[model samples]
Target: MTSFAQSERAGLCDTFLEVGPDAPTLCSDWRARDLAAHLILRERRPDAAIGMFLAPLAGRTDRIQASLAQRPFEELVDTIRSGPPKWSPMALGSIDEAANFAEFFVHHEDVLRGVDPSARRQLDAAEQKAIFAALPRIGMLSLRSCRVGVVADAGSYGRRSLRSPKDDHGNVVLTGEPGEILLHIFGRTAVTDVELDGADHDVESFRKTDLGT
Candidate 1:
């Protein structure tokens, strides 16, 4: 069976082809071609991927990524679709899913929703469960900037107190599917359907805060 990470990677490649290189994406200023180059660099050139998170190394990473972006867009997408090479840790079957699922899921949506905000993917049951299971840990990291506390209500999957309520900030209830909630937490609030139920101030504060990297 194809893992969710693998499926997302394949689907993203197909989307890149459909939209073409110049297509815009939810990722800041990156076009489809640029996002493709970033993915390839992240997986194939681990040395520079750190720039993705660290500030000081970003210039080097950007230079390398720009160089990679100059490659034919389709070729870059093909490199991502083909999966990591044998020498990379991502090539290990045991680590692939854990390593790529959230990364691919978010970036996949970034590409899709960049063009059509309402284009949300309907994830499978197993995928939802797996993602829901990961919510608490990632929720903490992603929502670190939120002024209000969050309770993720994933319907039947379960509910989690993503962050403890601050005395002054209050708490917000985020009601939605695992996938939608994930997007919202990752600073894609405008495109997500996750309903925010809370006091007026809390809801507004939640929306105003920037979440995730």
Candidate 2:
């Protein structure tokens, strides 16, 4: 089976090439060029990538990412298309599959869905399974502030708990294909098509929650 990670990478690369550098992304204040720089530095320069998560290091990270963004646009996009550097954790097959499946998927959507509001990708069963498998961990990052439990509806991929204290009644039951759920959890709630079922208060809270980047 083709790895979802590779598929997403290829798709994202193609979009980047198609759209050119100045196209906007769902990531606020970022364009395609900036996204490409982020992908490159995230894999090639661990020192600066830390800035993405570390407040004290953010300035350096921004400066480095800005520098990379200034490179020839095609070169930057090609670097992203070529995959991660050899020394990076993402270079390992297992790690790449496990770590980057959703990273690339979400970013690809960021580019695609941002450019075309009417766009929607129908993910296959295997792709949905991969996302379902990875949901628990990724959910922790994206739903850190969410108070409701997130349950995926039963389907070919089976049911999965994306968050704690799975309560079918009170907690939010997120009904959709895994890709939509992933996008919703990844802060694209306004764009992704998903069904949220829960008590009024819980659903409202879930709606207001900041599904972190």
Q: What TM-score against the true fold does each predicted structure earn?
A: 0.92, 0.93
**Model 1 lDDT tens row, 1-213:** 668889889989999999999888998999988899899988988899999889999999999999999999878888999998999888886588877888899999999999898786777888999889878878878988877999999999899889987769888999999999988898888899899999999998888888975
TM-score for candidate 1, residues paired by index:
0.92
Q: Highest TM-score: which candidate?
A: 2
Alpha-carbon runs more than 4 Å astray in model 1: none
For residues 139-168, write the lDDT of model 2, one tens digit per residue: 889988877887877356677777774344
lDDT of each: 0.89, 0.86
